[model samples]
Target chain A: MVLQAAIEKWSGKIAEVTIGAANAAGVIKVGGQETLPFLFSEGKIPNAPRVAFEVWDVHPEDWPPELAAAWGENLKDPFAWAEACVNKYQAQALCLRLQGAHPDYGNRSAADEAKLAAGLAQKFGLPMIVIGCGDNELDNAMLPAVSEALNGRQCLIGSAAQDNYKTLTAACLADGHSIIAESPIDINIAKQLNILISDMGLPLERIVIDPTTGALGYGLEYAYSIMERARLAALSGDKTVASPFICFVGHEVWKTKEAKVSPEQGVIWEAMTAAALLQAGADILVMRHPAAIEKVKQHIENLMGK
Target chain B: MFIIGELINGMYSNIAAAIKEKDKAAIQKCALEQIKCGADALDINCGPASKQPVVDIQWLVEAVREVTDKTLCLDSSKPQVIESGLKAAGSGSIINSTTADPEKLGLLIPLAKKYNAGLIGLTISAKGIPQNRDQRLELAATIVSACADQDFSTENLYLDPIVMPVNVAQTQMRDILESIREFKIISEPSPKTVVGLSNVSQGTSARNLINRTFLTMAVAFGLDAAILDPLDKDLVDALITAELILNKNIYCDSYLEAYRRK
Candidate 1:
């Protein structure tokens, strides 16, 4: 018997989302694949998955030493750090995490965080991803002001969760910015957050999903599988889960013992985690370490055969 | 699933009594209740019990209009009766349904085009319901080609492969399921698939269990629409979950609520 082709005749395509202000110099567009990633013969993948290097407002105390040394003293200044990421490392876009506002960190005010984000957006002039401190109360408190400061600048504001999305959702909607909805590893919860945010009137085209992946060898397959399943659902025409996914590739990679404890495995561990997600249907990859970012960029270019 | 609520038919005791008495309130109540429970559309049938199915179908359409504007699936063997219901339906209706018989298709296909309503074609004919997948496929291909000849959009053509009760015809049930998958390859733009879902469990003691289970399996095999009881909570839940697992809807914590609301 002849082998049957595995290609699916999908009626739905992933909703295309472009994260960059209308006035920004450039935009990074993701999603909008009519087939599973790299299934060239069956469907259309309009754009390649993008890689954005991360630069924190507060120096990350827990960052792996290899990751820190890769950036050197430029890490002290967020502007210089982001500049190097874009200009020197040829990073496509930039992600600025306002870690300083967390109570345990600098305990900085929301206004100060907003100012820092706005300054970076002005200096970078690229697709800027402005995210919160990863604290529910703090993120809810800080993201609104940051959203207001970058009101028309068109930064992608993060992370509305099930329990606390109202403030951030309202801020993004009022400010004309996009949002990233974060959920636990559960596929259902990931879909729920997207629905909830869209219910508050953010377009599905303006939202991206992050189904919280862990580092390689640490529940990575579970997270990767959820992303794979979600993408399959999107391709099969489920509008509720069809938004592009944005994975915090570096956050999870840096958290691993392989990346932090073992110097030999640091860069490759990040690359492997990211490369695997790219295959599993990630649309936007957010990372640290310029060396790893360079490797992922090369992999993505090769996949797109650019 | 594109669910057309089946509670408005005169075969049901409540609906039969309401149709005989011309009780507009009862008709409207049933329509609203089904819509509230998540029916995508409604099937309006004045079954053989009605002395005047033509007028009764018209009355059912207008009565449903007062309560909700959801699509009405006009059910009758007579084209005139379907036309009566269509005239009163105002807008957005489906002709449910026609056999592969050329004469029936000759009358109903034009009526479907005239009103711009959707068309459902059964895999049975004037001869009778098919005995196997090949027979069913032959009848279905005839309906699809006939619909295409009329310039009707094939996607709007819903093919119903007759589901017999499992108690008497267990083997036929497997053929019925296989035919749903085959119906997709019959034409360029395949006709949308539906079944009168409650038929699978008609004589069985486990009516709801059999209906929900069978409907879920049918959905997996590419059945996109059904004429079933949306008011049955368990049946609707099964349909929603099947669509979810099949990746037809996005998963959410409150996805059931979300699906119903959509």
Candidate 2:
């Protein structure tokens, strides 16, 4: 018998999203696959998956020793740290985590963090993803100011959840920036949040979905499966869950005990987590270890068959 | 859904008058309006009313070609009338039907291959319509096998199980739906499925309701094409909603508009 190819003739496609300005120095595009990722011979895969280095506005107190030592004293200053990542580590993009602005963590006000984001964007001039502290009230307060700070630059700002998407949606619309719509690793919630955000009149092209994932020893399978399903649904033509996926690989990786305490294993743990996410159809990976980012980039290039 | 806009048929008095008068503007308006209302293709039929269906179909095809390059379904049981329309159909033409009757298939199957047009084969024969799923399946397999033997691609063939009026053949409705699902298994690449949707609601008060509801049920069974009134907003809405429920389309607040815009 002549063997036949078991290719899927899918009628739907994941939404291809542009994260940075058309004229930006380092613009990134993802998620225009007609088939599942990296099935190059089966369908069209336009843009390759990418890696985004995560930075922070305030000093990260609980970082793994390996990560802490890698950045050294630059972690204290957001601008210097972001500059070092691009100039040294070849980070395609940077995600500025404003964890310190939470009411519990030093209570730095929204305007102060917005100032830090503005300064970092001007200094680094690379595509930046500014994320809030996951505090609903504080995120509602801070993200609007940051959205205003990077109005013309087409940067990615996030995360609007089920209860708190209106403010972030309004801010992104007013400032002309992309948004990261985060769902708690549930496909339905992920789809619903996208519907809610797009309902506010933000075009689907500027939205990236964060179907929140976990580290390797953690709930990795749950996150992995959700991301995979979202990608499949998108390719199968569900517009509500069709935006490009963005996973915070570094934040989830560094928070794990393996990355923090396992000596030699800690270094490889971050890479393993990121590798799993990339396989799960993550368009952009936010990771900590420089080696992991480099290794994942190489792996991504291979997976894309570039 | 492969909607074949059923407006330009001469069965409609307006279209009949337009066809009789050779009013290209009226026929062109019908074509443009149906295309605007989300018709994937248009069915050109001179109907029983036209004294000269062959001439009318040729003229109607030319009129529609003026406004858009969308696909034309040259709908007729007669091979000569379909052949006349095919001459004027610039491209993207599909032969509307051939019954499993050997004489009809012998005439239309070659036209389908000669024009390289997509074909719809009714699971019907000279002996009359299939009364149940087995009868429909038997006829459908015969049609598929005949197309295969004729070197016509089965993938381009659409099988219509010939929907009967619900008021008369109520029990046959489920069997019709079942045949639509089973027809795919008869070939390697699987022939597509279609229905002359409004036939189910003939002689009924709730024509639109029955048409949309049955159409929805058929969609759940993997219906690929339909020939009905694209102007029926409720019927189109039911189709779009059915596709969304089936996870075939992405949900947007303006999904109704989005589906039409596509």
Candidate 3:
């Protein structure tokens, strides 16, 4: 009951993390930490789970048709679409996916992605996260411009891999942006990338880790274990691993058949898929369905009871 | 590299009493002592001593700001206290935390944004305190991501990996070692990584003695800043020694100069 009580109390408060400049915009800070991840009462949760609405640079061709369908007319304009995610869905942050920059996607050049990102920055005053195509080289090229274009605003720039960190890290340093260093779900790799970034002489506080989440039935367990291990490392005073963790919850959820397909596929599939990922360790989820985000938030709140 | 003296926190009785009585002398004494000893900043925590912590904190922040231009580390869980302190500070200050709680993120990040203040983000989140380096790393990622959401400047954010007592958690040092090592890699362009040097030795005998050694080891592992006693010669020396060994300081000249000044 004590653990239960603690969990309930802790759930009410969301954790905070500040990146980018200590004094600049785009600083993400989680304020209340009532308990350990999911453990309530040990700490306090003062904020609600913040949401980030997703948008893409170009029309997504490979996405599950259902996801593409959700965006409908909004997909044509990144700015309007971003506004919809925030204004309509009450998203606190915006996730601008440079899907077009992908070689296999729309095949847009890095410069094109950067220019689009710049436009989004001009359009939205709220904090935004710019995710690059998975191509390391293109990400390296595109992120720097995005960082510069959003200078002083403190945007989050990503798809920064170990191999391509130098370019992106330099951009962040020059432009005052925070970054997410992603790694395959291996704990060691996650730690290694964190070290690499700092060793390049950047500060540890600016970087967050994306352990690479999987759909509920896909590799959620692995993501859970990776995240759990990373958090443990931070508490034990590993300043490097102590930055914070991020989950691509929406990306994973939308990709899953349960979330993407209709009830004819399986009546319980949608609920089951969303619930499973929430259990696994999703700090900041980027979701497509407003209802799904609400469902996950409610489940999290009910479980936390805070 | 701004080391905010953390002696004013409520966890200490003398400081709490001073804050309660509105004793400027006591507060001034602590402030001057740390500054004279080499602190770049003084963290003023009002504790839970008043019915309205924000008002009391405002008074204290003004009091401390009146004496020094050194930046302040505003430590309080309440946003109002932080806001009051920020308003009263003579210079930009560091938000003691936006912890890893999801809800608090919105409240704390905006303050950092509004005031153009530096921040300290704790690694522990809503889940609870992590027990090992891996979990700490996960929290570190969460902290950075949350900051990213707010658009906080990466250069200004400092991450405080929660440090438990090694006496209770023997592997804490190892955890810190691994976490810092990992944190450095994950943090792009390295955000400031700091720790409360005192936490490692709490409840242990020969605290200062233990603290010095731990501080040295932590600094070696990329600890950029420490919330500690500027007057502690041994601890200060240990940090200098670490800098020299790490070749962080071009020569032992800076170290010698510090020693000579003392």
Candidate 4:
């Protein structure tokens, strides 16, 4: 007797989202899969997961010694940092986080941040992901400026939460950029935010879900389960939850005590978090450490059997 | 829910006139309108007025095919009419129904298999509609067994617990709902379930209200598909909300508009 494997096929597909302008060196496209990640035999997994190096506009005083040493003085300038990431580090994309705009952290003007964004995008033609300072008020004030500066560039600008999404949604809609919808590790909020942003007339294809990452050993399972559930719901034909996922691997992983123990452990910690999320259906991983990104990139290639 | 639009049938005056005159424009228009309103498929019925159901069903299938590639459900009691529609439909169509009676099953199942179309099996026999859920289940099992014996995929089979009018069979409503949930357990990777939704509101004064409410309840009971009027926006809205509450559809602020667009 011959045995047949039961392959699970999905009725829905994850919406494919392109993150850069066509005129750029290259645009990064993610999520057009009809099945769960890496189940190539069951269905088509058209694109491999992408990795973006996280660049900060201001020199970071909070980053631990090992992480800070990886980029040395390049962290002091956004241009040097972005250039190194593109040319030296072989980075596929760059996520420029305007952490300097926070009141306590330099409180840089929106015009300055916008100039930095447009400059980096021009200097390095890779797909850009611009994120604002974590403060809601400050982000609202700053991201719109950045959105206009990068008009027609099609960068992935973030973080429209449930409480404050309209301004960023409207800006992204006008500026021709995609958005990252943030939920505090809650699937319902994640889906709800996607809906709210979409209601503003921004198509679902231009939105990526940020379910809010949690480091390994620090609520990783909770984040993993939420993402897994959301991906399954999407695959089962729920159009509202069908957008691609963007995981901030570096933001979550480097903050852990385990990462601070040793340099190799820190790299492993970040890489492991990303690897787990790739299995949980991460389309774009915003990471910090070059070593960790390399490790995860190799893992992705292996999983994709390239 | 897989909603099969019930508007293309000859029972409606517009469709009746279109069929009578072989007006392809009217039929195509109806097909496009239902699809725009979010119907997963359209049910093509010749109704009682058609003297030549065979030709009418074929013409209807061709007209609908010209407008959209959405699935068409060829609905008829006679196998020849269904076969004609199936021949015109090509593939990915559905056989609107066959009774649990082996004789009807014997003819329809092969036609369904040959055309690569889905089949809806009504859990009723020569005796008439089942009086209770158990009778419905028994007939469902018979249909499942028949499909299995004929080497037809059960996944392509949809078992319908014929919904009776609320005014006439009020007590049977609960039985019909229960039978829908039970039909899944009778077979592994269970066959899908459907209901001819308008039947429940057949003589009711509040037609739209009753239709939407029952459709919502049926959705909760795991009804997979329905032969329904997609043009009834309120009823469609209610159905979308029911699926949203059940977590089948993810919630959005403009979910009604979103569902229709989807």
Best by lDDT: 4
lDDT of 3 at A238: 41
Pairs clashing in candidate 2? A239-B250, A250-A286
Judged by whole-model lDDT over C-alpha atoms, candidate 1 comes out at 0.87
Q: What TM-score does structure 3 among the candidates reach?
A: 0.51
> For every candidate structure, what is the RMSD over all alpha carbons to the true structure, in angstroms?
5.9, 3.5, 17.8, 2.8
> What's model 3's interface RMSD, roughly to a tenth of an angstrom?
13.1
Model 3 stretches astray by more than 4 angstroms: A1-16, A19-28, A31-34, A263-280, A300-306, B1-262
Candidate scoring better on TM-score of 1 and 3: 1
Model 1: residues with Cα > 4 Å off, grouped in runs? A1-6, A260-265, B5-95, B100-119, B123-193, B197-223, B228-235, B241-251
Model 2, A129-228: lDDT tens digits are: 9899988988898899988988888888989888889999999999988899998888767777777787789978778999898889899999988888
For candidate 3, what is the DockQ-based docking class? incorrect
Assess the local accuracy of residue A142 in candidate 3 as a C-alpha lDDT between 0 and 100.
73
lDDT value, residue B260 of candidate 2: 78
lDDT of 4 by residue, B1-262 (tens): 8999999988889899989988999999889988999899999999999999999899999988988889999999999999999999889899989999999999999999999999999999999889998999999999999999998888889999999999999999999999999998888879999999999999989989999999999999999999999999999999999998998766656678767766
Per-model DockQ against the true two-chain complex: 0.44, 0.23, 0.02, 0.45
lDDT of 1 at A286: 91
Q: Would candidate 1 be rated incorrect, acceptable, medium or high by CAPRI criteria?
A: acceptable
Model 2 chain A worst lDDT window (10 residues): A258-267
**Model 4 fnat?**
0.40
Share of native interface contacts recovered by each model = 0.70, 0.05, 0.00, 0.40
Docking band of candidate 4: acceptable
